[model samples]
Target: MPFFDHVGPEPDDYDTSPKQDVRLTQLGSASTKTSFTCGDAFGWANRTPGVPDLDSRVALDTSTDLASIPPFLWGLIASYGRHTMPAILHDVRCDASKAAAGNGGRARTAYLRRHADHQFRHTLKAHADQGVVTRYIMWCAVRLFGFRPLGVAVLAGIIVSMLHQSSNVFVSVSDLLNKVTIWPWLSWLDWVPQGIAWGLAQLATALRPNQPYTGIMIAVATISLVALVYRSFERPAAGGPVRFSLPALLSLVGAGVVGVLTAPPVLPLVVVTMVTRFVLWLLDFVMHWLDLAWTKVLRLIDGATPSNVTVPEGAMLPAAVPPFPGFFPTP
Candidate 1:
């Protein structure tokens, strides 16, 4: 393969080459129905030019399971397909980077992680089968959150909002206690800590003072904007669960200032996006559960043991059963 400066793999990358050895077998885990094990070696040689100068060889063997799609995004994307090669490649690279970091290459981990994201974005752009919007969203998600789990990303967004709410409550209670000369017992508790309370209180009072949802709006907007810049050009964080870097920190502060000034009008839009996400997640969960149940039902109707219905190599479990009962053609 020749190296190219352009984004994405070579155009011939879309073809299924026999040399890739890309067979997969679905595991029989009820809890992880979406998981699949590679039946043979799957490999990608990074020929995309201008990416980080990390190792170009990546591979997945029989022991490695393909990454499962996050439940929240399932409605927007399928868990498995030829179009998902970019994601699969990304997963292997991230795992390899984690392993490298685990073996005391801590200083270089952040750089490796960034390269993985870059590689994923470019490769995703090359897949003509996936829509432009879908690729963009996936790229943005990888860039924003890196290899962090969906729960961590969600919590990151919510924690700031919670801090804002807690700060307001703390200041309000302190004020209320100050006026209560009638209760000397309550006054004793007021000696807690005013500095921390007042600092948080400033967030609530500084902008959109009367609005309770201001924190959520600012938090979401600040994170979204800062993450865009952070992954795009900001210095990568030191490796660990917690991510922090001077450039990212500065970006966050700047985005926060902008968010506080501009997020009020977009508060309703933020609320709607959050609600819509929850609804989509719920629907995805229900649909997945139903798919698994229906698979079992079909096995029972066909007189085959559900336990024995293993997914063969290079195959996916069917997404659904026949919709109508008559499709079975009862004798």
Candidate 2:
């Protein structure tokens, strides 16, 4: 019985011939659907300006859902990722960071609340506490207002132009998706579902590049531009809903600045200008579209208000406004 050569009962099940218990360690990640980037407000460093370091920044995403979105559906939606995620993440990060720093779960919001003006904090809290779905829908409305989807004519033109096979490598959304690995910079576009239709017209002419739809998109775009311009000049009647926003003009101005900055020898200045105009046009389109939708919604709500509630003679009405009889509970 040469126990030295063969395995034997030596301290439990240990091999007499030096066995290695190799455990493959894996990087662990949280099972959370949420992560925050207080834009690393905490990690931003020392204030002693005599030897100050640069206030470095990172593109912050306080979104839980973006990280959780299925790989296939990331494009087209991620660009419009601002809903409730950022706010939620901000709150969570503040709380966690404070806790980690051994400050009794002193959430950043809480700390800020202590110092913030009461009105501001109250407003922040109100917005922060809004139901996720409602807030998300609100954000969707915002997205609809801001982002102009590539129209049919625009897409067709881009496609036909591509088949003509000019030097442009960027063709369709499919092309972008296929060549994704090569351009990892565009990887963040994974959640941008609209990126599927990003082949939009930069110039007005591109809107109706083909003879078949030449008049269609041009007419639509022109009408839309006219309506937007008209609304810009038109003042809201007294007590009427103010649909036209100043943000659109600001956006156009910002776009102009961006176009100027971005136009280089490689990318044409006309392309930049056209794209800017197109974006503003899109914004105008969306704002009106949303305004119409909002108008309808408001009409419904207003219609719900019980009219003709008879007031007795000499009966003083309550100081407070009466609640909508059908929708709101009477206090």
Give the winner by TM-score.
1
Predicted candidate 2, C-alpha RMSD: 24.8
Deviation in Å, model 1, residue 284 alpha carbon? 16
Off by over 4 Å in 2: 1-217, 226-247, 252-331
Residue 279 shift from truth in candidate 2, angstroms: 31
- True lDDT of residue 284, candidate 1: 61
Question: Against the true structure, candidate 2 has what lDDT?
Answer: 0.31
Give lDDT tens digits, candidate 1, residues 1-331.
2122212354323223323225666667444334565543333444432332334333334333343445333454555665445555677677766776654354345456666766665665654245655555455445444524322344345445554545555446444433432135444334322333365466546533436566566665665654544433322444434444555334334433433443344343333333344334444666778888887898899888987876669875755422211111000
Record all residue pairs in model 1 with backbone atoms less than 3 Å apart, i.e. clashing.
none
Looking at candidate 2, the ten consecutive residues that score lowest on lDDT are 322-331
Candidate number achieving the greatest lDDT relative to the actual structure: 1
- Go through the candidates in order and give the clash count of each: 0, 13
